[model samples]
Target: MNCEFVIKEEGHLTQSENGPEVMYKEIKTEGDDDIKSETFPAGDPLAFEDTKLEMDQREEQEDGIYIPIQCSQTGENDFTCESLNDVSNKSFTRKPSDYTHSNEKPYKCSVCNKSFTQKGSLKMHLYLHSNERPFRCPFCIKSFIQKSHLNEHLRLHNNERPFKCSFCNKSYTTKSYFNIHFRLHSNEKPYKCFVCSKSFTQKSHLNEHLRLHNNERPFRCSVCSKSFTQKSHLNEHLRLHSNEKPFKCSACNKSFTTKSYLNIHFRLHSKDKPYKCSISSKSFTKKSHLNLHLRSHNNEKPFKCSVCN
Candidate 1:
């Protein structure tokens, strides 16, 4: 029977005086789910081919190769793929055969009800559902689901900003952030709100804008019944219930619940009145104070005078 052998160790093959040493460990038979892995050293003659092979033939796996296994399983073979025919380039193609394009997605995720053709794809999808972040940033308390995401996050700690925009000449640590900023210059708003028909550069911004029309506040405070459009806003609201102020001012030693509040408080110490009223041309330290001052010019009294009424 034709047995499908799993490619181990970057799917790399090493050439020796004996033969092309393809170190394969676990080989699954065609008929069953149970994998029967048997080790056999390089010897006299054991030819392996995929198509046009006899019942007692063995060959490389079709679709399941290069699915990403632990490095320990790779053995002592130099990396390679692109079918058994061409192995001279040392480049690997994870999906090269027509068999991989099957519409049948047997594996399904329980959390989000998402389905995938491969079991490995479903396993990777399941990572987003749980808080199982294997990769951690050394600079911050943040963690990532993949090591590649953590590698991109590490650029924030370093001085170098690799991804630069050609249009605006602005630099970003990550490519994803750089791409979103570049869209602003090009006016390429791919994410459009269906309700308002408003265009946004980013999908996250569009989702936030949709909240105004739909009133879809997914993040709700457990203590209070109040809901917020974003999770970060909900987190800030939680501090009010707990009476916790994490951000403290260095000059006056006054504490605030959020960093944005702490930054506004800094303006009071520096005497930097940035918020200027348009009507009166009067400057205020805080934007909220400037907004309150604007109400007097417009004769907008939200608070009622109980004694006069």
Candidate 2:
């Protein structure tokens, strides 16, 4: 008795016919939805044959029997057709067979709705959905859906640098990560700033640069509500909010927001105060102090005394 099961993992449907030896014919079902009627008898179940299987295409159907004009990996099977029509439409023709690999997809994924040309690919995808990593790397406990994926994962643990960068001696685990990092070495600035005419190698860098041009301070310090363009800048600003100044001045007991600010503050201790009052001979440790002194010498009140006025 002939039994029909969902074709998974491409293999032969071997059976001994009761009558004359049945010859197997390959069917093309690329576009057709209803697949099952088309069948051909052959000698062995594993013997690959050459059949003219033209996927879903405009063809003449003689007495409802679609002739195998071309060989393909698919076919449309109709269960409603009569036995006589079925025999007529399902008859195989004789011709020289040229065995070639087919790119036809038989199974589809139910989780991600991704279709694959082979059952093995669909099976691998199913593993990702189920989180079932059968293959594990020996060096690292990292698991993979397939043995090939596990082999690739093992390279990182083994320190096997398979993919090398063209610009630097640095290597990576995968070609995709290497390709992304390669842009850092290239002079190409594809990501352009929308506010200013500046460009950068990465989009995120360009976005941060754009905030400087637009004065876009999104990340605000919770203590002072003083905003910054970048998250790191806000984090630095938060230290002042908490009164937790980690950047201490070695010269003096004063604390600063950053190391750079501390370095600038350290100069206050030295007698080398380069910022002298432009108007008067009075000198100061910081430029801001000298600037205020210069305004006093000029007798110019930029910040108006509204009450006196």
Each prediction's RMSD over C-alphas, in Å, is: 11.9, 17.7
After the best TM-score superposition of candidate 1, give how far the Cα of residue 301 lies from its true spot, in angstroms: 18
What's the lDDT for all of these models? 0.61, 0.55
lDDT of 2 by residue, 1-309 (tens): 343222211112211223222233344343346444344433332232222232111111111232232112223221212212333334444221222224445567887678865344566678778999887677667777666566667787787878898677889987766766888777778888766678887777788898888889899877778888899888877877677788887766788788767866777676667677655677777778787887776887887777986
lDDT of 2: 0.55
For model 2 the local lDDT of residue 286 reads 73
Clash totals, every prediction: 6, 17
Q: Which stretches of candidate 1 lie over 4 Å from their true place?
A: 1-94, 97-99, 220-225, 235-309
Each candidate structure's TM-score, on Cα atoms with residue i matched to residue i, is 0.50, 0.32
Screening candidate 1 with a backbone cut-off below 3 angstroms (N, C-alpha, C), the clashing residue pairs are: 1-55, 1-56, 9-74, 12-78, 12-79, 12-80
Q: Residue 285 error for model 1, in Å? A: 14
